[model samples]
Target: MTERHNAFFTDIAEATRLTQAGRLGEATALIQRSLGGANLSAEGARPTDASPAPHGTPRLEGPATRLDPEVDAAQATLIPERLRENIDHVMQGLRSLVPSLNGLTGGGQQAPGPNGTEPDGVASEGGQFVERSFSNAAGARDYKLFIPSPRSGPRPLLVMLHGCSQSPEDFAAGTRMNTLAEEEGVYVAYPRQTSRANAQKCWNWFEPGDQGREMGEAGIVAGLVRAICAEHSIDRSRIYIAGLSAGGAAAANIARAYPDLFAGLGVHSGLAAGCARDLSSALSAMRVGAPGAAEPGGAAGFGAGAVTQKLRVPTIVFHGEGDGTVHPRNADAVLAQAGIEALTPRQEGGINGRHSYTRTRYADDAGRIQVEAWSVQGAGHAWCGGSSAGSYTDPNGPDASRAMLDFFLSHSLTGGQG
Candidate 1:
């Protein structure tokens, strides 16, 4: 690797190690120094009596948690060494807490995935929870795979990406995807994002470097999917992916980067691709969402000098009206990428004994539900209708897992979207 590239990975690892050691200030500071010294701070860690946005409320700012890591020569030059030194304290802290992902990193061939199955949750059902690793030009990360019991014909594949500070086991247990995967005879893959990649293990959804068709995190994830397809008898046409928070954002970007590979997508509490250009924009997007998502091109083709291909995969989005982290406005952004604004929506929903939701379905000329979105009232930044055994789950909300799977089964690569 070039000196600059090696330095990039090294700094990422060091920053993450510091954050894991309860040295967040040092972690972000380390990142600032590397990225020409911007700044990082933790403020607004309390709620206010302020009114929420008419559609989706801004995520309540709070104490700085582990921030994401993203970098590249292009991004380094975008923010000069002297920048952010004079910005307002709150904006300084907000921008400081997030990282970048300009497209100028990653360029390696993927090594074969050498792995084996181990016993876990679905073992009794004759299934296997296997741990594996995928390394390429970008970097190396571990991921877990849940293979259902031996079935007759080919089965579908669902790629599950976890949010920050979560593991495959934790996400699997909370989402309860394994049991459902076995019951439905599907294969579930949970890709791991290391602290070395981001202190909080957040997918670098805001990074331009990570958004490219075959570079950085996006490339690694796509490469892994290809490897799995080669090794397993996966129903190539029924492959799908989903995630929460940062992972949700990453899933959107990766699916867009590889439209022909994935048939459908599910994003829960995540922003659309290109919604963020940097740390400050990322914070604003999480709060009230970035502007221009509903414009002619949507976020996929928005941003300054960043023109992306229109999203093609069928998508299902879920967000809590009460979530204070990633706002509900972002859900609209995600739907905008589905390119279904012209289609008439069939809306039908109400409180399900626990939480009220507005489910909107958009159909094409052929009558296929091209887009599906759910907004749960009184829900926070947690997975809806998820099992309490795991973390960040709201059991009272609608069953998102079941609903997403059904959406995936209904679509396929052959005719997912035009």
Candidate 2:
């Protein structure tokens, strides 16, 4: 259809469909588009003066809609009655509530659709928050990318994965990675792990079927990374991956499955390989953590050894000594397997027997796998030096965020081969 006709048809469809579907905000958007296209007033056939009303006056129309001045001087004046009514009806239908539910009864109102992803798939975009969806025969996933304004030269991309039972916003706020990304000149993307894979919403990193080549969960992650790179001019050589717990394991899988795609991997209180060889082994490996044993996660008779054989990239490891979920021993073994020999600790005395790390090259050649380990004294399974606004967070140890960024920024693909 022609643009003009499309607008008319959209307005008609929106008004009819949204009213029936009880989605007035979307209907209003369609109406506005129609008015803009037809050069008519915002209220469609309804018209109003282009100029503002006199300073002391408030405009009113019959029952269609209403408007009233919000200031103190206009208490007694009745605003556009038709406009006011239309807005109220739309607001109620749209289910847009005042921020917070302290005042509203029965909690707040229902969002437009499942998980607030409207059937029409329209949501407010505030920042570099770009919403994109990807799907294949297996399933589909939705992700968001936050890019800073006035893009700088090709920037490093950090793929942030959310933990079990969490969404991208939940993970973003919990990690506070976006704040750091803004400070640094880097771009960050959050890939959501759907709940269908596991009831707990954990990434199925422990499943034998979850690893190797383009198959199962690994395939989904690879697809996401490829799609993101294709859509954005991401620095292919500077791409890094980080995740927490389940998400962390998924990050490791990504590095292992597609070593060429990622420059480094950050596993936070997460498991390694050899844990999910078979059904029973997968459970044990996931619960106990993967380390030392070769073939960290594969079938029982599938060979016994660590999965990290080659020095694909430098890795920064972080784990709390008091971690109850994933043992600190796993961290040590991962460093050893990845060939990261720890140098002397930095900042000797702090709350958790304070220590920051310095790493040397992975092999005899320079620019190979460089690794650092943060052993936070008495710290638990949490973000080292995380804010109080999140869970599984502790701020008493070396800041993991700064260290990871530094490691990621220091290495480049071409310069690493010397």
Best by lDDT: 1
TM-score of each: 0.68, 0.64
Candidate 1: stretches off by over 4 Å? 1-124, 292-309, 415-418
Q: Write the per-residue lDDT of candidate 2 for residues 242-281, one digit (tens) a residue.
A: 8877677667767777778788888787766434554455
User: Candidate 2: misplaced stretches above 4 Å?
Assistant: 1-127, 286-289, 293-297, 300-308, 341-369
lDDT of 2: 0.57
RMSD of each: 15.5, 16.7
| Window of ten residues with lowest summed lDDT in model 1 | 102-111
How accurate locally is residue 220 in candidate 2, as Cα lDDT from 0 to 100?
68
Q: Give the TM-score of candidate 1.
A: 0.68
The global C-alpha lDDT for each of the candidates, from Candidate 1 onward, is 0.70, 0.57
Q: Taking the tens digit of each residue's C-alpha lDDT, what string does model 1 give over 326-397?
A: 888788778877776766799988886489999999998888888899999999889998877566788897
